[model samples]
Target chain A: MTEKTLIDARGSFCPGPLMELIAQLKSAEVGDEFEVLSSDKGSANDIPEWVEKAGHELVESREDKGVWHITVKKKR
Target chain B: MRILIIGGGMGGTILANNLARRLSSEIKAGKVNLTMLSASEKHFYQPGLLYLAVGQMMPDELYREQVSLLEPGIAFHVDPVTEFHLDENQVKTQSDRTYDYDVLVIATGSRVNMEEIPGLAENAEMFYTEEGALKMLKSLREFEGGRVVVCVGVPHKCPMAPLEITFMMHDFFKERGILDKVELYYTYPIGRIHSLENVAKWATPEFDQLGIKYETFFNMKEVDGDNKILRSEEGAEVNYDLLVTIPAHKGMEVVESQGLGKDGWVPIDRLRLNMEGRDNVFAIGDTTNLPISKAGSTAHFEAEALGENIASMVKIGQPVRDYDGKVFCFIEAGKDRATYASFDYLNPPDPKPPTRAVHWFKVAYNQLYWASARGLL
Candidate 1:
């Protein structure tokens, strides 16, 4: 069984949410999944871009109630 | 392990607090010690000065007690550092105390030298400090109309402040019904309006639309207050009734006094952030000679990077990550609109058109910055 880590990165500005996601992904196991909730529109777009460039798997991306939900699975 | 962080400003404070959290167990077990020394008991939010100058915020909102922001398990002090004994891995403070550390982080920050230009300090309006911002507000209130020249110095903190202030001033005068009476002119030391290429491209059209005249390649040579004349190194002179300036900056006094780097900017490895030759000695924020924006986000990101690395070094004997030269800045485009530029070492930022939503976000960020300083946000 794999656990999904949820990070509440709302109210933080650009690069804050992305950084938190990266910090978690750095220590996460290869198959572990982590989701980040960010109110910053810039970081919502940035997290997936970073995930793609970093060779991670973007499992899901959605928006609800002005909050962005981005989930990525560790591939490395 | 003794971690001595000198200068309890944004970089040092964030790094210390972050380390305190990551190494909490080690701290409790007496395996690690975290100490910080700063010059002041108050931690100032520098970005507030811009809003203060524009009357969007007040002075009392910009300060918080430095020790109040720190987490427990980190030893904090207000004694300023006087000397750097890097060879002995120790530092001497003004109160005649010596601190030794296995790892040293130098976040001493930078300072503006307005005196470098003759008549500048005495005559021009500057908003880099609390007093400067208050004085500028008074000057703005007293002035009805004239040629207001906004000249910028190189390597200053907050790369967006020059343009932000210019745009905000336009709105300020407009709201005061003196928009047509004031002739706002801007000057930059570089060929472009901003050091960043993309920002210059974006701001040029905005300046043209706003009726803000500008001259590039204008390095401030001196200010003639008596004659109201401003001279640049390129020899083109600008005549103005009111002079607003951003003075050139240099690293902290101790950094220069100890022969750290040219003009007090200690050279560091871009990724590792270690002072040129020493692995244990690290430099960040405005003090490092990195060709990047000297903004708060730069320091924040660098501190987090250093914190993680230091913690990993204490636990795993090596760093797991590197700083990618990240910087994020919100550009206030006046009239209650703003946009942001976000980029890193390998990527350049593409700032979109200003939006009301982005502007409100910036306004909210002014309040949220407190949480950020506490390493909470």
Candidate 2:
């Protein structure tokens, strides 16, 4: 079964959003979908880069009212 | 006999590794055992984090696996200490496991107390932890144009960090093309910009050039988040759009509970680092109320003295070695330049001096210290 988790990093800055995502990814099962909510503009672009470089799958990404919603799936 | 060391920070880890290398012969002779207990499994290159905050380095570059840094025959315990039974000469972990030792070294570092001031932890941010630094970096990047206040609370670790943040913020604003719109202000409890006169000599010129306003002898009293104002104990109020504060520091709760720290920190003899009026107990790093700046370099120097003293105690059964209370601080001046100062209370012949060469020396010194501690060189 697949599960989904959301990390609200809206008020956090660059690596904060990415670090939150990583902490969530640690507890997440492979193929589990995790979404990160970040108000940092860099996170919208940087998270995808990290996910790809780390061999994780970026499920989806979007922006709403200055908050970026980025979803990723743990690959391993 | 086993030697137990608590707190695997700069002091504990360096001492453990140095002892392991220097005392291998004794260990082979079935004389001594060494163990280090720590809560975290990562050895942070904390000095580099200052660079990381300004996007100069990545997180991975500032930390390494703790297990990888330990030499053979040294035992590592990844656990938080629950209590210290000084009478029993043992420590109990959170899991109810107890370890007895012939000697105990307390190196548990200081803790940031954000709750000391109202709305500080609620609204203002810090730069001590990795999370805090990352959050601060994010905020600095998103900072477009506004009055940013860098406040230094009373008695904090790395006393120069707030000043460093101000210099970096000045550089950040200049690079973003908003130097004019952004007003930089610093409020500190100290009488001068830096405790050391040598560092103030180098830093004051940079502050003047950058137009960063600072108030010395202004003790931060409270944070009025609703009004965007920080009030000092002297009744002076400074208004700001964004506030970044270095909060007050305190000894670990465990230390306080065990009656180890009085006067806000563990009181140890400056010479031997042994707890006053206690046998077989020693302390190092920020945990001790040493009359010096609580910096990592101080901890590293103390650890060397401690390791040698511990070896002498175990091998020759001699009295502890004397610490000269020596310290050097690397002040990061903007424009990719830094200045260093050397101070030792006992060095009357060559009192504390500052040299331009010390600036470049600090860079090379860090690499040498790290490599030597990790046994890589």
Candidate 3:
């Protein structure tokens, strides 16, 4: 079974969501995917930008009902 | 109507965006022209410099192109204004271009005066600018352990920065397993290291817990670079193996040369934010010699009232509200914990206790600030 960690950073500020993602990514095994839910207007742009800069693969990103659902796959 | 904003730093950009948003109709109808004169094409998120010193943020992440953050309707001019002639209601740029405006907002901000303290520019590393922060970062990486003194030479921007550096250095040394080998010191001009009374009370115990020494009322006078000693005007001396000092800050030379300032600092009516003698010419942020922290947060607050007043003046030839001089700034206490303080002209600083969550909020603020600065937030 594939396990995915979920982080609900909705309503948190800009870097709050990004930092949470980084903190969770630290202990995740290689190939582990994490989905971060954020409501900050800047998170959609900030998270993907940081993920790319940190050499991680962004699996998918979608917005549902004013919330951003960003999924990332841990790539060593 | 022509609105010219000088200095595209924090205050200018925020004011421009707010004005653009408030007067979108007039702007679209070609009834008003709004132009911003910035010294460079880039706007530095200065509060992030402290983060850069500790390697928490990259240099490129702390700045954005000036034009990128402005609305398409606002004109962005990358040039430094050389002269402001209030008598003629005009400004002259270094490129020999002149811009006349019905209203002018001076947000040129402040600059460091390294020469104010002898041997400072020659020896110590600083974190006030991009170059200074990078140099300090390189020096910090090479530091093994020793006496590290963080000194504030004058009323510098971000009153909490020296304390942040002190706390962060202690944390940095601890993480490197050299905390025992390093002696940390924080020096400021006042009895309390911080300008805010409540924050000082909250940080005093933290200083003891972090093993950081606090030296008060020690205003820097000179630096003996060879011996690594800083002499204060109060006759106190601090020795350091590595020193990161905040140099004396002053208003821009252009503002002073134009006789718009006293002792290189522009004095404005705090509540009005208008030049002492000129109503159409206003000043905000570090450019004004206001008795408040020169942090961007204070400028952001001042811009709120100034923007409304400017908008009312542009529309009906009169201001609607008086500025409250409110300010709020977050203090990072290292180790993923931060606190914040809020104050106004009438109220003393009231600080919220430090917490890990607030630290995350500060981090989030750094990222959100870019979009917010562009008026997206």
Candidate 4:
């Protein structure tokens, strides 16, 4: 079974959203999809970079209504 | 459970607020008590002081009442701590109030000691404090132009400040139409322009492009104010018309006087953040002897880690998390473009090229920092 999780890390700064994503990814199964929503611009740029560094797949990233929605697929 | 946090700076405030939110039910149930002891009623956003020196930010824009930023669950006081009794789990304040805590967090932060350099304090302009920044602003405005030497010392609180100010001043001179009159010479104590290698790599070309002259391994030995010359420990010297400096920093006086850690920085478990032998006691941010940048972001992350751990200790049996040595800093490339450094214990920062969008974000973060202290961001 696979699960898609949405982490509303809005109103958090750098490493706040990233830490939350990593925490959630710990329990998430491989191939799980995680979407993080954040208002912080630092996290938006950072999340993609982190995802790439951690060898995860960055599926899609878009901004809407002053919030960024970044989707990632857990690879490990 | 009684938790006492000393120092109302970024780390202490964030930890207190985080605990307030996380342990609210316990606080309401009379199972938890959170108290904060601070040296000042005003929480000055220290980072804004950089812009303040350059006149990009004003003095009024940098402060908030310590009481206002806290959640209702916290008991706040303005009495500065005078002594730490780690054996008895107690602290004595300037007001003669003794506080006992089941858990204690010390975030007393660091201070600039310009006096550490002979003739430097009186001769050079600085931006480490409100008064100093204001003086620098006035000095910058009065100056027609000459060689402006930015001499930096080691272990300053903000890792990027020296570079940030140097780059920002370049634009300031350009805007004032004195770009031709001023020569910018930046000096760093280390072998590289920055303590962080990648940041040094990223800045070298930028410095070249902007014609910002720099000298590495230029540790300040003394300032020959009479001759208007700067001397370095490495046997180098330069003549300057204007001297700006970022002095070496030490952790607060109370920390050192109380035998907490050498030079006021408490030795702590890097991941656990506990005072080496005392688990009930913890240190964060600039107050710790951790070999990392003593910036607000370091404290903020440490606070979050402790917040979770402390709250969990109350709700469960043990701490739930560990601090992973994370720090994020935005480097203002110039007046309008910026880049950032984000890294952890296992990673080294590889700063990307400057972008206008990132600069706007750094601008936004200046205001957002308040919310961050409130543990909202």
True contacts kept of each: 0.00, 0.00, 0.00, 0.00
Local accuracy of candidate 4 as per-residue lDDT tens digits, B1-377: 99999999999999999999999999999999999999999998999998998888988989999999999989999999998999998999999989999999999999987876899998999999999999998998888999999998765778899999999889988988999999999997545587676898999999999899998757688999999999975578999999999887888999989889766879888889999899899999899877667788999999999999999999997998889888999999889999999988767789999999999998899999999999999
Candidate 1, DockQ score (0 to 1): 0.02
lDDT of 3 by residue, B29-91 (tens): 998899999998998899999988888999899888888889867999888999888899999
TM-score of 4: 0.83
Considering DockQ, which of the candidate structures 1 and 2 is the better prediction for this target?
A: 1
Q: Report the C-alpha lDDT of model 2 over B247-353, residue by residue, as the tens digit.
A: 76777888988778742478888788899888699898889866556778778888889889888887788856688777766766653556555666533112133
- List the lowest-lDDT window of 10 residues for candidate 2 chain A: A11-20
Clashing pairs in 3: A15-B364
In Å, residue B31's CA in model 4 sits off its true spot by 0.8
- Give the alpha carbon lDDT tens digit for every residue of B119-215 in model 1: 8999899999999999999999889899999987765778888899899999999999999999999997555687556788899999999999999
Clashes of each: 0, 0, 1, 0
**How well does model 3 score by local distance difference test?**
0.80
Better of 2 and 4 by lDDT: 4
Model 2 stretches with alpha carbons more than 4 Å out: A1-76, B347-369, B375-377
Model 1 interface CAPRI class: incorrect
Deviation in Å, model 1, residue B134 alpha carbon: 0.3
- Listed per candidate, the RMSD to the true structure in angstroms reads 14.2, 18.7, 20.0, 13.7
**Which portions of model 3 show Cα errors greater than 4 Å?**
A1-76
